[model samples]
Target: MLLILSNKKQLLLQAKSLLLSASFQQLSRSSELTFTCHKISAIFKQSRPALFNNLYLAMSTQPAKDHTEGHKIPFLLDDHTVTTVRESKILVILRGLPGSGKSTLAKEIEQKYKENSRLFSADEYNIKPAIRSSDGGEYAKLDEDLNTCCERREANLIVLDDTHHDRERLEELFDFANKYHFIVVILEPKTPWRLDCGQLKDRNHWKLSLEELKNLRPALEKEIIPLYFGWFVTKRDEDALRKTSQDFLEQLGNFKPFKKRLQAYGYEDKHKLDLLKYFGKTPNILHCTTKYCDYGKVTGSEEYAQQEAVKKGYSKAYTLHLTALFVTPRTAGARVELTEEQLSLWPLDAEKEVMPKDAFPRGSRAHITLGTATEVQDVQTGIDLLEFIKLQQAGGEREDMGEICGGRIHYYENGMWMLTLPRKIELKTIFSGYYGKAGVSAPQRGGKKVLLPTCQVM
Candidate 1:
């Protein structure tokens, strides 16, 4: 990565340092560090001639043995690639509560497009004489099977029918579609939902009455909760990140450009930036987001919630490596380095929401929010990270005005910049999931739960 520098001398120095650090990391992981260095050299050669000069000189001095193995690194997926994939296949996601007629609509849609469409549902994955009880494991398996159907179904259109009432669950489906290059169309049943399944002749096809669907929360089920899965930061690491961010903000307050901007904003005392007061404390829930599902509002979220991989990996603990600490006037945060295993749960287009598909690769903004400006949402932290990285990618130069006790500070345009830490910080974190407020209720296990007429899904 070509981090912006204030001057030529610092640029060369930081470039050398960055390569050495990457080399060490690569060496530790495998014998691929040398090739990675060469790739960096190539990137710099094309985008940053000055820095490449320094890197080339340094690489010339290294032993030839370092270049023994070479591997071609793939480029990021561009719009053309995604567009072509989407053109070839499409995915239709059906959403609604049971008895909302989701199945009937899915069947009709599939039949109408029979020549090009195929339908998949959780009911197909259920065992013979399947029980009606809410079970996480069973749902997990069904999610996996549904995903498999998406992957292997030989058709231009695939329809997934289920009670996809939660958003977080739907995000998973989008993730799958991204991987497979399929376009997603969500269809919610329009018919009014009735309480009963109307006494199906099949004994195994049991349905809950309106009363049973209004009291208890369903465990491990996608319909009841809006779950967000991510990597949580440890207490110690979070403290260190917060301290670094605070110091960076204080230095930012001292910058002449920043001071002038503050004056323009009506701040006479611009020498000391009240970073703590200006930017509120970091959120209590510190995490590197893997996915954000807005209660199944996002396309394909319901299928994602039931995904088997997510279920099995839920709540597992892993070590997170902090690569850099960055601060902008709007936010302060840390960029996390995700391991291969961790990447499996990461949403393919997480960064694309803020930056264009060609601008940054997937997961480029994976970060922990340390703090945010007044009235800013916590999610802005990742946006700030993308802006910082984008500037570096463009070989945009900033002023290396000073340094902190823990890192070096550089000033970019618009009161945005980053503090590059001298050392990578590693913290132990758990792979936890989140469920927002229960928008709907389920039947109590042993009691007769009260029914609400409005309790329906779509």
Candidate 2:
């Protein structure tokens, strides 16, 4: 007999002899309870009526467990009923080290079901050179493949084969299961399989070593924790935003305040501002941060992550309204106005971060960081937003910097500027739970090149 506690669900694995020999008297006397009495009673009632009668007799001789502390037995669940329950459409999410038999188990399950199941493997897509060319583009392709499978699922089981070390990534599949009303069954091996095995090594497959995997787990989890969630700009809108940002940066150079500040810093090149280098590279993950959890590192983050409403809304798309663009010496970002529906997803205490309690409105710091200053981390963008909001609240006289690129520039103190767009840009975006490593190179296959545009907008 064996007992396992996982995700609050208990599993009882037993031999037939143990099941047959188990009596009410023996069950009542045993200190180790594998299952609640009601569960045992229900199972016995269906499988062995005689045993259940004896169990009822034994229950009459002793006090029953308090109802509040025990599960209510709904019905006598027979083996057939149990089998029927298990036969429902299931999403089996396989998670483990690269060589730890995930794909092997997936294949076995697929074969067992044959025509009643299908397996979706990320590795299958990874091996194709044409699909593996763009950085961060594989996620979109994987989503497309998974969505396609979910839409046309005529099977009892769908096996998702991937190295789902990140919880947010796993949540993406979970969201699909929740939408399609499929039960999620997560399978993870206890021990990691070696990635450097002879056969695996010979295949030239991408994998992480045991040590590297161990080191990466925390970082991946931290990133996956939705430190901040926001709507990613659509492909069409992203192009316009990029152009608008570049033109704004060039226009900033013409301003007297900016010129004086640059000259003060001993910069004499007036012909060309080279603002692109000053603002640094554009962010790989583009979205406004509604809340920053700091990888569950901040207080109350754990509670926030576990909120039922938060989980229910995970990965749902939203339309964010861009109200204005803000700039400081340290950052360039967009101010977003959250709607009523969006506000429901935003935590009440999100704005309490790095500020005096109740100082700013709930969603005042909602902004997308276009670029960050050299040596500044992305999180600093939120701080810059808070600073801008605070400055506005202090009621400074706005220096009308006039119209530039169809937007009005109003200068705030301390080299801070707000360019309120003539019209709010309504952007269509999907909620990506986690952003992977900032700029990872796409995997190469077979020494072949995939032709891509040099000036791609998205």
Candidate 3:
């Protein structure tokens, strides 16, 4: 028996070497030989189980080249690359149906943040899974607990685990986050069987039926609030625009009025204004921002995105006519003139939000930020444009400083300058949402810096 076992091991080792040396395609070219080979392989696998198992394990564990490149699922947050923020508060809201693994994800997040995180769950508060009149009291207590945490600044990362199917409930949480200045991030589970009602019926602790799960799906499906909705510039157009913007900036630097304004703003070296460095490199994709939905925390964000016109416009192409280029002390951008058809995607109260009392047209604030000044955010570009519009409305000073780069320049108050082009520069763009990364860092109110490994933007 010992001699037979030794011979079997020797034969298997030789077969392994042969298998490694020859490709399966090469071996399978001969039909008769292939059939014989399969028979032999099956015999070895079935009879010599111990030896074959080792061979299988070794072959299976061999490293292969990764082909995914840098592409990642936009909604999923990687656990390994999670970062920590200093003096910044984060509110992570988990939304999903019963048995959708929200609790499991919340626990994982809690473990990752450890001491710096506080997790709130409906189950802990003895709140029933279904929406009911009696459940309101339990939910109120949960909110109070969360409020206390935010008030005392007890945790850097606060996680709320619940179905969150109700829009009103989400609104209440958004209000709390806004008041406390906490960055809100809404996450849903990435489990494959999350929406499979049959699987959920078996997996759910509540033992919810398929009917109940089906009813919940509609509410969640109707609204999907993105990070921010806007028109994305194509790669080819973006390159062209970059060059065009650079040329405009160069000519403006040499202009005498622009130079005179810079000198007034304490730029002693008129030659060294360096408009390129003054307005830093664009951080994100060049696009006209429509609505800044801070991850579904913004008021009426879901409803707005679900509007028929907005929904139809999403991912659709439109040619934006660049009417002018404007520069403020804080930002530099191109003013976009939306046509009647394009104005359908524009939010009704877009301008009213900026100047509530003033009655500017619906698409008055439509502009793409070419660049922003040091320490200034990209959102300021829209605000600056509105300021320019307000002054224009009030009949503020507008000195025509002559044409440069086929556009006439005008100077407003405090280094505010604009170049209105005679011929509109048109660029094709697609309406979409920006979900790249969360910019949640801000000045710390007062507390120790907490290292949160899982508080990442989805």
Best by lDDT: 3
TM-score of 2: 0.50
Q: Which stretches of candidate 3 lie over 4 Å from their true place?
A: 1-224, 269-271, 436-458
Q: In every candidate, how many clashes are there? A: 16, 1, 0
Mind giving the per-residue lDDT tens digits that candidate 1 earns over 1-458?
A: 33433344454555566556654224434435455555566556777888677667765443222221211000012332222222335566766455445566676656656765678776677532222444335457766765676667667567887755444555666666545544444544433222223422211143555444432113212243244567655444444555555555666666665675554333664566665566665554467777776556666566665676655454345677877777677777888888887777777677876666556866787898877765677778888888888888999988886765456667777767676767777765545444433352211111222222221110
Q: Cα lDDT of model 1 overall?
A: 0.56
Collision pairs in model 2: 227-293
lDDT of 2 by residue, 328-419 (tens): 77778888898887777777866775676549987787877777666666667778888878777888577887886577888776667888
Q: lDDT of candidate 3?
A: 0.68
Per-prediction TM-score, please? 0.46, 0.50, 0.51
**Candidates 1 and 3, the one with greater lDDT:** 3
Query: What range of 10 consecutive residues in model 3 has the weakest lDDT sum?
Result: 62-71
CA lDDT scores, all candidates in order? 0.56, 0.57, 0.68
Q: Compose the digit string of candidate 3's lDDT tens values, residues 1-458.
A: 78656766665666566556654334335454445445445656777778667766754332111111211222124421243222235577878788777887777678767767899998788765666463456588898888888788788678899888876677677667656655555666656556777877876777788888887877765445666888766544555676777777777877877776775445764555767667764634577878878767889788777788876565455678888888887888999999998888888888887778888878999999888776787778888899999999899888888888776788888888898887888776656665422345322121222222221110
- Runs in model 2 deviating more than 4 A are 1-119, 122-227, 261-272, 435-458
